[model samples]
Target: MREVFPDAGFREPVEAAEIVEAERRLGQALPTDLRQLLLESNGVLGRTRVATVWAVDQIVEQNLRFWSDENFAQLYMPFDALMFFGDNGGGDQFAFVQKPQRPDVFVWEHESDSRR
Candidate 1:
């Protein structure tokens, strides 16, 4: 990940407790690798040339905002099933599907209102 985003800047490391609390509040467990990344650095700053990974708090805030939007919520029902982690410099977002088995990562584009 670092090699792909050499210019990425990171926030101070976050506590495991914080990550756990975030998961609890969201009513879902985050992916293991993402949880580990948050413990290392809250999130990445600067441009990754892909997306800027949002800090834990930002993650919650953004998710809440999206979940509250009628249009978005309706379009993406069961929004809780997806955990948003980052965003393209534009309005697109990145997330992981919370399934029992492998959690596949996907990109949600605001322009298209579609996930890929």
Candidate 2:
């Protein structure tokens, strides 16, 4: 993960480890760049078309842009996060999604989808 984000600095290395461990616990392997981008940053960045899962008040908000159309939304059991499942082309393109569902979850609407 460090190799993936050489310049993304964090206040503490332990926090980065925590993020990696959290990903492992969730059973969701994030794209290296995106994961590194998120993990390395203190919070969401601004003005990018790419969707993000913002950390807000004990919950996370997600916005998805650019995912395989074949992949349908499904509940990622136990983790309480939505996931897209499909077998098709792979690209740097990703459908940004968030985790830890709640009424206050991050998003303009309760849910949304878009292509990057």
Top model number, TM-score:
1
lDDT of 1 by residue, 5-82 (tens): 678887799998898888887777788878988989888876644437888998878877776778766765556667
lDDT of each: 0.78, 0.33
- Model 1's C-alpha root-mean-square deviation from the true structure amounts to 2.4
RMSD of each: 2.4, 12.0
TM-score of 1: 0.83
Model 1, CA-based lDDT: 0.78
Q: CA shift at 116, candidate 2, in angstroms?
A: 6.3
Give the lDDT of residue 66 in candidate 2.
19
Clashing pairs in 2: 61-106, 66-115, 66-116
